[model samples]
Target chain A: MNQPYSSALLENAVNEFAKLPGIGRKTALRLVLHLLRQEELSVENFGNAIIKLRKEIKYCHVCHNISDSDTCSLCSDPNRDDSIICVVENIKEVMVIENTHQFKGRYHVLGGVISPMDGIGPSDLEIDSLVKRVSEGGIQEIILALSATMEGDTTNFYIFRKLAPHNIKISILARGVSVGDELEYTDEITLGRSIINRMPFNETFKP
Target chain B: MNQPYSSALLENAVNEFAKLPGIGRKTALRLVLHLLRQEELSVENFGNAIIKLRKEIKYCHVCHNISDSDTCSLCSDPNRDDSIICVVENIKEVMVIENTHQFKGRYHVLGGVISPMDGIGPSDLEIDSLVKRVSEGGIQEIILALSATMEGDTTNFYIFRKLAPHNIKISILARGVSVGDELEYTDEITLGRSIINRMPFNETFKP
Candidate 1:
């Protein structure tokens, strides 16, 4: 239904909210109305937060991850391993990996994978910078922690080929049933891969 | 899970977005990322629209609906019936009624209903203004078009008693099965009410 918003200002705000992903006009209206009820300073702070982030946000010069300074905190931290680099698609993946606390290596954010369907190529990503980082030498291992999708596989293969001549170890995330998944419910490919790449019984069993 | 956002700016924006109703941290991150991908000018416009709206929006002095000016377009329009007023809970109800293309009378927005559970009373709403408007004379009828909840009924009764002194005709919206609702699926209370308040066959029948 066409909303006859009594105020043009209200309509404009709603339109702006509706432009966001997954927010429709009805929900946009609800969000706008909620904001309208808030204290003016709080709403101003909300608006300014978004504007300031877009205007002043920086990217890590080394890894291409979003950063507050020229070099991101993750890349500059002395405790993180400088010899191994974990490669991922974007800043979000970096956050997820960091939360896991399993990988202590520095990150190499590719920005995005090679998805030709969306017209994204290797040049569109930070692949050249990744190669440069590897060529500069000290990184002994490159961990390719990308998605399990076809595009992720294609990108992983491409990156592997590019870094192959450098004679460094290249690895991808292990493909297997999730920790809590029932063996009967596991997909054939994952189950097969889990068997093929199975660890020795003594290594996995503590008892 | 704790998100280790690489940039403070990104984290701040996501936190602000997460403050909105129904939006969680993960969804907030997605929205903030989406905004980051947009052009600087567009993102600025998004921020400016919300700020400008909150900073500049006005309320109609007569009807209390959100307006660009002191007098809303609906209250100022000469074509609408000045003798009748439709009392609604908020601006959204006014839009819903307007979209139906049925009501041509002026509207009085109550801002909210009398919900003692929420600490809202008659004084908290525009009920006093509504009573004052009626006491000033010229209004022949007042239609109570609030929600179909207990709070709505209580507010309607309160307003009915307040307007009883003014001696104007007071009415309410018809409660019945929805237009497309099946009789079997309709609740007993609604079915009973529809039966008790059944309309004259000829008055409702166009054919």
Candidate 2:
């Protein structure tokens, strides 16, 4: 009886959703109230979006990147340079690299990186698939476009080691990317330069 | 014919929307790509929500707050004290005041204040309706819960002068809210205390 203005149900839902990354309680309340102020069609739509996002969306079977279908359109593309595969940390990175219009190479998304602190390790990454893909031949060069981080380096080394025996030319997207900065945060020019100045990982980058 | 990446249309839309106020491009892309990744129901739902929000929601006639109906529930609530109307800058402020549970009074939402630089004036506010509401009344008091800024003070003075002819008990929310601070950022406890210990501005609080 002493409730201030509205339903607790609405407040509870807002509080629950406000816990998402980059969302504050105030912003969450704003979104929730915005939704509440809408017609039932909007409310139903919001709920369906949340539910469908959680249930329907899945990673592409081949690349492990987010996709509406099993094999992503990039993986199925016949024109993309299949002889060169550029590896990235996330699907978001894949888009960033693609937006530059420089690289026509295919992308391999690692789902995540190898960080023992975050409980991510070699087995956790898709290093085996990278190795298998390179061994299967047509791949002439494998470029590592991972972020400049301790964990990103660790993951890169693990992939490098796994592909060492393969006949493909192995290279890492250049060094000017300072440590602690994410690849996603880098501008397109810098990312492009890093890709163009790729170096062979013989020793320093070996796992 | 020359797009290299998988879902170019969805990717571009995600990046554009992410640049908005609170949504980062990653989250924006995540949301847009999430829609692309979903079945038809989810995508349609997201579109429907945006449309319903724009079309179905309208300002309540009495409180001038968002609602599906003519009058907000607060204005129609029989238990709410109609004689005491607390005036606030925006609907967000209304929620803050309501969260305090201290005021059992009705509300008059001004929409915004008299900022001549931004080209807003008294006529732009719901001041005329407030004057009419105060004029027709069993009203004992009109509490001003405006922000303690230059523009807020200006708006308060304008309202005070308009409602003064009615010879009603007119008070403003305290200066306890520090100089150059918005009403929204003030905590509930501080805001509630400011309301309870309000000051009567007759001639001294003017420009």
Candidate 3:
């Protein structure tokens, strides 16, 4: 919809809302109007939360995941497998893998993957910290649990080369049809790879 | 996805964002994470916009429309016809009509429609103020431009009864197949009504 002339304050609020990903002018207007109808205290609280998040939120010094304190809860928890670190593209991926309850290891968020097209490289990520963590020793393995994209491959390869000298075992997430997917609908590339890398029947049955 | 635990500050921001009309936990997390990646100054500006919007915004005394001051630009404009008032359910409708540039009159925002299920009544809206505006004796016409819903109809009837005593010229927004709509795909009721109330070809071409 064409922008209608309104009060400057309303316009400003709408413009800020429109800046959010996936929000357009119409949705922004609706959101701003909804906020206008809300109680002043609630709106203030909403604003304060965002402000406090940016002002006081910190990153885990050990893994670079977002945290309330110096170290993330997972990093500080001794029960988690610190010796087995899962390297991921971002904090969201860390959360995604953590939800599966499959891996009990700690994480190292690269902040982003290597995408030279986007001006992102190994230096732009937390590769040096990951290498340092391996150099410090006692790290049994480093799992390159990144997405199966060009950038993900680039990041995985870069990290692999760096950890090769340390003689640390490196692994990438297995490529396969996702759980609950129909075999008929599964992509051919993934199906072929999964078959080629098929584990022993007893080993698969153990899980 | 099951919620992966994160910082309390991050959770608070996500919770606040989730309070919006259609935002869910996942989308809220995405928005909060996006804000987290932004510059501190930009996030602060976003927060301040909401705070300032709630703190400084006011309603126009005459029409109950949202305004930066007691009197809105529409209400105070000398070029607008004060004699013709457009009664709408909310500020959004006012903007919608204003965007069409089809009305050169002032507006009366009812804030919301009368809905017993929602516990909203004529008293809860700006009905009393609208009656007062009509009773003051300058208004010649009132265009009831509300949604075509039960609550909208109820509010229109209620307002119509209130203004009956003032004997002002009352009208309603035209209901038909929307402009640029395909007749075959239009709802039956609207299409039937449009045909029954069809205007002359010359009259339709005038605009």
lDDT values, one for every candidate: 0.95, 0.73, 0.91
Candidate 3 chain B: 10-residue stretch with minimal lDDT: B1-10
Decreasing TM-score order of the candidates: 1, 3, 2
- Candidate 2 C-alpha lDDT tens digits along B8-87: 44444554444345776667666664455456664554444444555555677877865556787788889989889999
Candidate 1, residues B139-185: lDDT per residue as tens digits? 99999999999999999999999999888999999999899999999
Query: DockQ winner among the candidates?
Result: 1
What are the root-mean-square deviations of the candidates from the true structure over C-alphas? 1.7, 8.5, 1.5
The CA lDDT at B144 in model 3 is 97
In angstroms, give how far residue B129 of model 2 lies from its true place: 2.3
Provide the DockQ value for model 2: 0.15
Best by lDDT: 1
What is the DockQ for all candidates, taken in turn? 0.88, 0.15, 0.74
- Candidate 2 per-residue lDDT, tens place, A57-95, comes to 556777777666778888888998889999998777887
Q: DockQ score of candidate 3?
A: 0.74
Candidate 2 residue-pair clash tally: 0
TM-score of each: 0.97, 0.67, 0.96
Distance from true position, residue A1, model 1, in Å? Answer: 1.9
